[model samples]
Target: MQDFTRRATFGLGAAALAGRAFAQTAPPGGIPRAETPPFAVTPEPGASLRIIRPARFVEPDETIFRANAQRFQDKFNVPVRVDFVGWEDIRPQTAVVANTGTGPDVVIGWSDDPHIYAEKVVELSDVAEYLGKRYGGWAFLAEKYGKRHNTETWIGIPIGGNMGPCVYRASAVKEAGFERIPEDHDGFLKLCLAMKKNNKPIGFALGNAVGDGNAFAQWLLWSHGAYLVDEEGKVAINSKETVEALQYLQALYPAFAAGTLSWLDPSNNRAFSAQEIFLTSNGVSLYFTLKNDPGTRAIAEDTQHALMPKGRATVAPQTSTVMNAMVFRHTRYPKAAKAFLAFMMESEQYEPWMQGSLGYWAHPLKAYAASTVWTADPKNTVFRDAMENRFWSGYRGPISQASGAVAADYVLVQMCAAVASGQATPEAAAREAERRAKRYYRNT
Candidate 1:
């Protein structure tokens, strides 16, 4: 499989720090790279703070981020260099620069990134508390994704998150003889089975889909009351709930289209847009893409989103990316970095940024929920209640380096894929996954 994570491109601007391009070259892990748009901020003489973040998959959203950073620079008179890295490479890139004390002053990364770089980043308790008090408090998931378990330290500030609601063609569901979408596990299975009769197979990423695959797999396991680990970070995958989850996946495997096992983040998007798929789990990116394109407007109009169906247990699906901004201790301008983050969080700046995303970025702050963006569309509102359901890969386990390791390695997704492909029995897959997880959680 092509390494989607390594295929990230850098966006270097003319005003980039020291005129050096942080653009693409294969990093240590065999990850590939690409270059993004030019650097957005033009640093003044003697102004030298730099921030690195994942470039949005949507080009317009990336522009919004750059514009917002420029706002910070114009207001604070601090020339901030912003480097937008690819989603697959951001974590590793952050790790490399952070450990060596030479990365950006600020970084925006996915869930558990704060946990992964907890020691190397500055404690953000003061910043978090200030934001919490001023913004009517952080949402539960924000707190969960931003801080270490059982500690007062805030490793990063949860800004916003990307949601993975079940995106489907509403027309397809009705054609399959369902009055509404499935609400329970068995009902959902029956719907998929029905959809299969017409060859409109349900699609979920089975391969190295860093976001969709992991989020959907965890949702399946959690719905069955299974957990990858216990609350304290112990390996707890070998169980009835887990076995049932795998078996459930195996039963549904026949309903998935061919090549699903190799799908990455962009695969389902293309499939849905082309009308080749009836159902899949993904963010609003697919919807937004379709909506913005005149040629695909029909598909966009027909698309709808909902929460993952319930199983033996009722819980919200785990979010794929709980986005946060981290400041490194090695930053020569810690104060400037913090100010930039805080300035960006203000309602004036944050709302417009979310608006530019067109429902792709949901608010991590409760107060921001009242933004018109959430109510502008049915697809957006359906995900409002889902915002609080977000959980990192560590879920029942503590968010630590071990939990981060498991997520980065795509452990649960691989386990489910193994069963679905008949490569291993559910029991064997569960046991092997447990063994692998034990190795990751060894020190924690």
Candidate 2:
């Protein structure tokens, strides 16, 4: 899911566009053209986005995010236009665009942070349910998860998704003398100890920067049978399960690549790429790590991906679909905007989205998931099976907004840094994290 190796699947299958799925009318690497009757949406014909990026993607295919406005316009029979801006000027220039409300028909690619949720993004509950029922009721998962959110609003919908429990080279684990993947929390720790004796870092990202750590930590904490919030919607990181997961990681840290504290997306990715670390509890970014990079791809080629080893924590990964898309309150054409949003949440729209985002997003609409196509696709359906009664919109806590999330990535990193650097004890770090979480929830 990191910027570097995640393939371009959204616009994939368009003729020869670098890496995306082929849509019906796609001309070799091209965007899918709308098959519906050419129904033009006339919104006074004024929509645009600063054709700029803060950190532009290296691949030329990345340009399609902006380049394809014409397709959206043609399909909707609207006169929407794409405005050009270099990355350097994009952010500052947004003030003028946003303030004037003369921006693009829909924003492209810059969604992250709670601002997207709180401000005006599309909510797909109705669409999710529609797609779910149409696709065989798997669409219900979206509304089930999205409904009654802490925010009293459905924030976003995921177009594609996958979760990795714990990834270890099967051979590496057996070489370390474990017969199979650990079945519980303690077994995982023992496996780590064994690997440490042989000098291998238990390969989960711990740098508390952003995406990587929160996701990794969530899987571990859930496996260990704990979470950031208690049953009372209060901070619970100090619970037994939390402590066990915390110490397990701390004890296993030294066996990992040196200076892991300084690690984030790239450095830790490099370690995994080089086969310097094994047994990372992470998502499927390993696909790229193993396939793309020249250095690590060789070893990664032989690695086996496995379900996250179960812990005393048996819960499924919490769905991020709760907050990826939102509808604008000020949308000039609410019906048309809603229609587009509706299309996005449906199984058909998501099929393309899943391939495009490289599965970084999961379908928030359960309706879309029930599609035979989704259930049948090897890559798309694995997580669907795991989602049975396992998914959560977000932590069931006082924090009302799904966007008001304190990702496990940041929490785990700060905790590890404390103990690894001798800056704090595991217990102390846990307590501080709890205190901070409590404050965050209360304020939110």
Question: Ten residues in a row with the worst lDDT in model 2?
Answer: 48-57
Candidate 1 yields a Cα-based lDDT of: 0.74
Model 1 earns a TM-score of 0.88
CA error at residue 379 for candidate 2, angstroms: 8.1
Q: What lDDT tens digits, residue by residue, belong to model 1 across residues 84-197?
A: 676667778877877788867888887787787787888877777767777677787788877788887788888777778788888888889996667677888988888888
Candidate 1, position 419, lDDT = 90
TM per candidate: 0.88, 0.71
For this target, which candidate reaches the highest TM-score against the unseen true structure? 1
lDDT of 2 by residue, 29-142 (tens): 222223433223333444321222222223322433323433444466644333433322433444444456555434332223223234554454555444444545433334
* 399 Cα displacement, candidate 2 (Å): 6.0
Question: What's the C-alpha lDDT at position 426 in model 2?
Answer: 70
